[model samples]
Each structure stands twice: as C-alpha cells, then as structure tokens.
Target: MNKSVLDASALLAYLNEEPGAEAVEKSLAAGSAIGTVNWAEVLSKAMEAGIAPETLAAELEKRGILGNTLDVLPLTIEDSMEIARLRPLTRP
Candidate 1:
C-alpha cells in the first residue's frame, strides 16, 4: 500500500492544483494522513485565502476528506517532543 505523511505544502499543492499535485493525489487516493499541526497549517492557509475555516472544513468533511483520503491525526507526545528536539536543526 502506498502511503505518506503529508505536510502543509503537499496538501496546499493538492488543494491549489499546483505542480506535483498528482503525487499528493496519488498518496491521497491510497490513503494518507497529516499531523494535527500540519492540518492546522492547511486550514490557516485556506483562511488566509478568504475561506471561512468552518465552511471549508465542513465542505471537506462533506466531501469525505477525512476518513477517506486523508486523516488528520493528533500528534503523539513522542512526535511533539521530537519536533521540539529537532527545532534547533531547522532554519529560523
């Protein structure tokens, strides 16, 4: 089974139909997930684009974005801690 841990950029590409969207779409079709924080990032970007978060969320849900193609998963404690630990490795 093809799978991937999608981040905000990948999701945004798919949503915006940008280049490389097909790769994201493929992962989505095979089922995929995003960290809750990444999920928030996607929603935040949508909101910045004038979409009401609730409205977009509702539509996505209605369209089965959740439970079908993508799963918005809560970050586990280990995941959060790892992110914190890796913070210093990332650019500011």
Candidate 2:
C-alpha cells in the first residue's frame, strides 16, 4: 500500500470536518503519516482555535486517531531536501 504523506492542511481538514475531510479520512484509514513539522502546524492551529494542545491530543487519542489511524513521522535530511525541491512547484 502506498502510504499517504499528510500535510497540516489535510489533517486539519479531517479534524475540523471541513470540505475534503472524507478524502483525508480515507487516506488515514489506508495508512497515512504526517511529518513532525506538519504535526506542529496542526498543534499551532489548534492552539489558535482555543483548543488546548493536550486536550486536542487526548481527544484524538480517544477517537483512536493519534496511533491507530495516523502516524507521526520524523523528518530526515533526504525528506527535507525533497520538500525544499518541491517548494517551488507548490508555491506560486
């Protein structure tokens, strides 16, 4: 199975039940991962939304999202380089 690498936007969509959330959920169900940087983005967004980081994490854990559904991946040097390479294409 091809594991999906979820960005902060994707995970945020799923968490907030926003548009495209189903797609994100599908990715999660089929084995997806978020890099540490993206995970931090999610946490930052949560804090901005007035949701305590621990509270949000606990809620995710209760729903079996943290471990069962989504995996957090640490970035390696190669991964950083790849992201940097893709940055230009991803940005206008």
Candidate 3:
C-alpha cells in the first residue's frame, strides 16, 4: 500500500477516536507520515486538550504510533511552497 500523508485533523480525529478514525488507523497501519508542521499542530491541539507534551508522546509511543507507525517528516522549502499552494483546497 502507498504510504499516506496525514494532516493534523486526521491525526487528531484518530487520536480522539472521532469519525473517520478507522481510515486513519488503516493508513497508519499500512505505513504513513505526517509533516513537521502538522505534527506541531497535533501537539498544539493536545495541549489545548490539557494533555502534556510528554504524556502525549509517551501515549503515542505506547500505542506504537510514533516511530513504528507514523513517520514524522521534516518540512523543506519546497514542501512549504507545495503546502501553501494546496492550502486553499485542503483547509477545513
């Protein structure tokens, strides 16, 4: 299966067990990645939910979602431009 790139919302939905989580889980299980910016967004949302960063990291690690399932990709200049170009069409 092709590796999928997960946005902040999709990861958040999976983390919170909300709708569409199953799809996110399937993607993760099949190998997926999340860009650094989106990972930051996930951290921000977790903070807003009163979860400490360490706790969140630990929880994800325990669930095998960190290094094993989801790979976090560092943002590059070209990636930034691409994200900007796709923002309008992708933003919820």
Candidate 4:
C-alpha cells in the first residue's frame, strides 16, 4: 500500500474491463503507479485483444494514464542487478 507499486496489473485489468476494472480506476484516481515495463505488458495484452497500438496509446494518454503522467518509474540499479543475477536461474 505504501509503495503504490501494485497497480499496473490492475491498470491492464481496467483497460480490458475485467473483473477488477473499477478498483483499478479507483486506484488511478487515488494516485497509483505503473512501471515502464508493465506498460509494454499492458500494450501487449491490448494488442492481443485487437486494440491498435496508436489508438490504445491515445486512449491511455487521454486518460492521463501514461506511466510518466501518473508515476512511471525506471528500474533501479538494485532491481536491474537482481534481474541480471536471476537471468541464469531463468535459463533453466
């Protein structure tokens, strides 16, 4: 709750109008964040659902839901380093 790092999935859910879209909308209004990486994930899902990228981007921009507008954070060194370290584990 303190970090607000848990809403990207909800954001995607909201875009898809899934079960928790309302909560995601509420979270967005209350100041939640979306990671840059998660933006790709959201876009990917939107594409898979037949949403055109340009249109989707516009929708997100209009809603002021683009990561930068709401709080799009880049990976910190520690996070990237850990992901690098975990790459070997991912191989298997």
In model 1, which residue pairs have backbone atoms overlapping below 3 Å? none
Candidate 3 segments exceeding 4 Å error: 86-92
TM-score of 2: 0.87
Q: How many Å off is the CA of 35 in candidate 4?
A: 1.2
Predicted candidate 2 versus true structure: per-residue lDDT over 1-92, tens digit per residue = 33798999999999999999999989888888888999999999999999999998899889887877788889999988997999999887
Better of 1 and 2 by TM-score: 2
Q: Flag the better candidate by lDDT, 1 or 4.
A: 1
| Residue-level error in angstroms, candidate 3, position 30 | 0.5
RMSD of each: 2.7, 1.8, 2.5, 4.4
Model 4, global lDDT: 0.71
Tens digits of per-residue lDDT for model 1 on 35-72? Answer: 88998998899999999888877877787776677888
**How much lDDT does each candidate structure score?**
0.86, 0.89, 0.91, 0.71
Q: Clashes in candidate 1: how many? A: 0
Off-target runs (Cα >4 Å) in candidate 1 are 84-92
Model 3 per-residue lDDT tens digits across residues 1-92: 33899999999999999999999999999989998889999999999999987899889999998988888889999988997999999878
Backbone-clash count (model 3)? 0
What lDDT score goes with residue 78 in model 4? 90
TM-score, prediction 3: 0.87
Instruction: Please give the distance, in angstroms, between residue 57's alpha carbon in candidate 1 and its true position after superposition.
Output: 1.7
The digit string of per-residue lDDT tens for model 4 on 24-81 reads 7776666666667886787787789899777888887787765444566677889889
